[model samples]
Target: MSSQPSCSQTTPSSATQSIRPVSIKQLQTLGGASGDDDAL
Candidate 1:
């Protein structure tokens, strides 16, 4: 009598961490391993 589906999931250390600071036009649109494409 147990089909299974009830874990509820919320455990990455209670999840909520984003100090948010990534701008140089968003790291040049993040396409080249993001170091502003190796300073072009």
Candidate 2:
């Protein structure tokens, strides 16, 4: 697999921009339902 950090794992600012347009719930799904601190 490629050794790349996911969008969610990127810097908060970058992640926010890259994930822009995606709803919080959608982000949460991509982030998973474990309630990870970075879900938001």
User: Which residue ranges in model 1 land beyond 4 Å of their true spot?
Assistant: 1-32, 36-38
Cα-lDDT of candidate 2: 0.67
TM-score between candidate 1 and the true structure: 0.17
lDDT of each model, Cα atoms only?
0.44, 0.67
Per-residue CA lDDT of model 1 for 1-40, tens digit only, reads 1323222233332342221234544555775565666886
Tens digits of lDDT, candidate 2, 1-40:
3435554466677768867867776877866765765665
**Each prediction's TM-score versus the true structure:** 0.17, 0.26
- Index of the highest-TM-score prediction: 2
Tell me how far the alpha carbon of residue 35 in candidate 1 is from the true structure, in angstroms, after superposition. Answer: 0.8
Provide backbone clash counts, one per model.
0, 0
